[model samples]
Target: MSRKLLIDIHTHLYLPRYAQLLRARSQIPRITTLNGEERLVILAGEAATGRPVGPSYWDRDAKLRFMDTHGIAISIVSPANPWLDFLPPAPALQTCEALNSDLEEYCATSPEVELGGRRRKRLYGMGYLPVVPGQEVGGVCAAVEALGKLPHIKGVILGTQGLGKGLDDPALLPMWESIAKAGLVVFLHPHYGMPPEVWGAQENGHVLPLALGFPFETTTAVARLILTGILDKLPALKLLLAHSGGALPVLSSRLASCIAHDPVAASRLAHDARYYLGRMWYDAVAYGPEELAFVVPTRGTDRLLCGTDHPFFPPLKGEEMWMSVTENLDAVENAPGWSEGEKEGVRGGNAVELFGL
Candidate 1:
C-alpha cells in the first residue's frame, strides 16, 4: 500500500538567526539561559516559567527527527509566536530578511532529509515579514515581496495585530494588495490573545488565556476582516486561519446574524459573513473528532488542513510521540461521515494544494 502524504501546516520553529536575535534581547520574547539550557520566554506573564528550549525549536535535525518519529511526511514550519514584532524598523527589516532567508535555506537544503527510511523534502517554511511599529504599508509591501521571492516560503505567517492596529487597518490595504498580487497565502495566526482583564481576577493560570483567548482573538480578527469589508476589497487574497480558523466555523452564522442586524456592519460587506468564511482555509488544530466534525461541514473538507503545533504542545514525556499530532490525525480520520479519501484530504492533501507543496 502507498503511504499517504501527511503534511503538517502548523508546525513552528525558531530559525537559528531569529533565535539568536531573541537571545540577545533582554525583555519578554527573549531567550535566557537557565541551568545550562536555553528557554524562550515570550509573554511577560509567562516569563517566570518560560518554555523549555532544545533542538526541537531551532535545530533542523530535531525537527526532522520528530517528523520521522511521528510519521509526518512534510512540515511547512513557521517561526514561533511574537516573531519580529518587538524590533524597530531597521532591525526588524534586517531580522525579517535574515529569518526568511534562513527559513528558505533550511527547507531548500533539506530535500535529502530521510524521513523514516526514504529521502524527501520533508521541511518547508512560511516566511516572516517585519510589520512592526514604524513599518508602513510600503515597507510591509517590500517585505511581503521579498518574502514571496524566497524559494521555499509557501506563505507568510502574520499575527492578529498587523502594524500595531488590528488586521482591519486601512494602512494595510496596500500590503494586502501586494500579497494578493504575489499570490501568497497569508496565514493569520494569533499572538496577543486578549487583555488580562478578560481572564478575571480569579484566573491566574494560562489555561484560560491560551484556550479561550487565542481562539477568541482569531475569531474576532477574522470576523472584523469580513465585516470591515477587507475580504470584499481583497477577494483574491488567500487566508489560512490557524487553530481551525479559531472558533469561526462554529460561530460564523452568529457573526453573520449580527452583521444582518447591525445597519452599518450589514452595509459594509457585499456578502454575508459566512460567505467570506468559505473563501479561507482552516487548520485541523482543534484536537478532537467532534471539533473536526463541526469544522468539516462549515469549511468543507477541501478547506480543512491538518496541523500539529509541534515543539510547543508536544508530548510531556521526552520519548513519547506528540499527542497533539496523533489527536489531530485521529480527528481527521474519524470525522463523522467522512470517507478515507475525504479524511485524507484534510490530513494532508488540502495543505498540498493550499501551499502548492
Candidate 2:
C-alpha cells in the first residue's frame, strides 16, 4: 500500500536572518529587551505572559524533525505574518527580494545536512510580496513578474491588505492582472485580525484574536474582492484561502442574501454572490470535523487542502499533539460523504496537483 502523503500547505517559518532583524527593533510588534532578556512579542493580548520564541521558528533542521515525527511529506513554507509590511519602501523592496531569493534557493537545493540519519525530502516555498508601502502599480506588476520567474516559487503569499487599502481597491487591478497572467496561484493568508475595539476587554492572550480574528479578516477580504468584481475581471487567477476561507463557507448564504437585498452591491458585482466563492480554494484548518464537513461541500472537496499552522500552535500543556493540527486532520478523516479518493485529495493530493508539486 502507498503511504498517506501529507502536505502541510499553510505552515510558517521566520528565517533566522529575518528573525535577527526583527529582534533588533524595539517596537510593539517587534522584539524587545526587557529585564536584560530579549523576547519577541506581537499581539497585544499576548504581551503580558509573552509567548515563547526561539530556534524552532528559524532553524530548518527543526522543521525537518517536526515533519518527520508528524508524517508530513512536504511543506510549502512562507514567511510568518507581518512580513516586510512594516518596513520603508526601499528597505521593504530589498527585504522582499532577499527573502524570495532565499526561499527559492532553499527550495531548489537539497541541504547536505541530514536529520534522523536521512536527508529530508525537498521542501518548497511561496515568495513574499511588499504590499505595504503601496508601490506604484507599475512597480507592483514588475515585482510580481520577477517572482513568477523564480524556479522554486509556486506563488506569492499575500496578506488581507492589498497595496494599503483592502484587496477590493481599484488600484490593485494591474497587479492582479499581472499575477493572473503569470499563472501564479495567490496564497492568501491573514495577519491583521480585527479592529482592537472588537475584541472587547478580553486579555486571553492570543487565543481570541489568533483563532477567530485571523479567519474573519480573510473572509472579509475575499468577500470584498468578490464584491468589487476582481474575481470576475481575472477568472484565471487562483486563490488559496487559509483556515478554510475563514468562515466564508459557513456564511456564504448570508452574504448572498445580503447582496440580493442591497441593490448597490448587486449592481456592482458582475455575478452571483457565491460565484467567486467556488472559484477559490480553501485549507482544511477549521479546527473540527464538523467545520470541515461544512466547508468541503461549499468549496468542493477538490479545492480543499490540508494544513498544519505549525510553530504557532504547538502542543499546549499536557497535550502530545497540537490541537490545531489534529483537529484539522480529524476533520478530513470524518467529514461526511467524502469518498476515500476525495479524502486522499484533501489529505495532500489536491495540493500536489493544484500547485504542480
Candidate 3:
C-alpha cells in the first residue's frame, strides 16, 4: 500500500500581521535586536539564545513550501506559543478576534499555489481564545461558538493555563461546556514549561525547556484535568494533547498508583484513571522509535496522530531531514505490534477522520 497521506497536525505560524505585532512589542518572549542581529527571543537559552525572526514564521507561502517539501498533504495550523496570553482584557479580546479571523481567512480563502505542477492542498486552522484577559465567561463562550461557524476552523488551540489558575480551576467548566457544545476540538499545547527556577542557574537556553520542560507541563495539565474529573464532566469535549500527551503514556501507571495510595484523592476521583487517559488523543512527536512504540499502544493507535512541530525545531545546520520530524516518522514506522494499516492511522488517517478533513 502507498504510504499514508501525511498530515502535520501540530505545525505553527506567526501570521505576517501577528509577526508585526510581535516585533512591535518589547518583551523577553518577543522579537528583539541586539548587536545588529534580529533575534526571535521566544525563551532565554544558551544554545544561540534564539534565532532571528523571519519570513518562515509568518509568510503563508513559506508554509506551503515547507509542506510540499515534506510531503505533507494537509496541515492544521495554529498560532505559536505566547498566544494572546499576555495581553490585557480589551486588547486581548481584539487581538484574538483579529488573529482568529485572519487565520480563518488564510486557511479558507487562500489560493493554492502550484509546486512541481501539483497544487498545494488547502490548509485548516485552529482558532485562538483570549483566556488570559479575564474575559467574561459569556464572551469566552461566544468566541468558541464563533469558531464553529468558520468553515476552515476545526478547533481551538489552547495553552495549559485555563482562566488564570491552570486547567484545574473550577471557573473553566463553563468554557469547557461551551467548547464541548460547539464540538470544537481542544488542541492543548504547552507554553509555560516548568517554573524557571526548576531548571537551575547553569541552564542557559531552550534545549532543556523545549525538550524536557514542555512535556512535563503538558503532563501536569492533563493530570490536573483528570484528577478533577474534567474528562468525565465534559464527556463530549475532544482534546488533542501535544508532545504525545507529555509523557502520560509512560507515567500513567505511576499516576494511578499515586492516586490509589491516597485514600481521600482516590475516593474523590469520579472514574478510573485509565478511563480518562483512554478518552484523550495524542500526537506522535516522541523523538525515538522506542518512545513512540511505548506511547502509541498505551494511547491506542486510533488516538495517535502525526505532528511535525514546524517553524519551531527547524533542521539543524546542513541537515536535510529535520531531526524532529524524522524521529517522529521513524517512530511510527517502527512501533511494535501495530500493522501497517494501524501505523497509517497514527501517521495521518486518524487526524483526517478526527478533524473531518
TM-score of each: 0.95, 0.92, 0.93
At residue 176, candidate 3 shows an lDDT of 94
| Model 3 C-alpha lDDT per residue in residues 89-128, reported as the tens digit of each score | 7787788888899998889776664433466546989988
lDDT over C-alpha atoms for residue 165 of model 1: 85
**Candidate 2: misplaced stretches above 4 Å?**
1-3, 33-38, 111-121, 318-320
Question: What TM-score, to 2 decimals, does candidate 3 have?
Answer: 0.93
lDDT of each residue in 39-154, candidate 1, tens digit only: 88887568877877878888888988888888778899988888888988888888788778888889999855444455657778888888887786787889889877887888
Relative to the true structure, candidate 1 has a C-alpha RMSD (angstroms) of 2.4
lDDT of 2 by residue, 18-39 (tens): 8878887766567766676656
The list of candidate 3 runs beyond 4 A from truth reads 44-48, 111-121
Superposed by TM-score, candidate 2 places the C-alpha of residue 322 at a distance from the truth, in angstroms, of 2.7
Residue 3 local lDDT, model 2: 33
- lDDT (CA) per prediction: 0.84, 0.81, 0.81
Assess the local accuracy of residue 17 in candidate 1 as a C-alpha lDDT between 0 and 100: 80
Model 3: lDDT equals 0.81
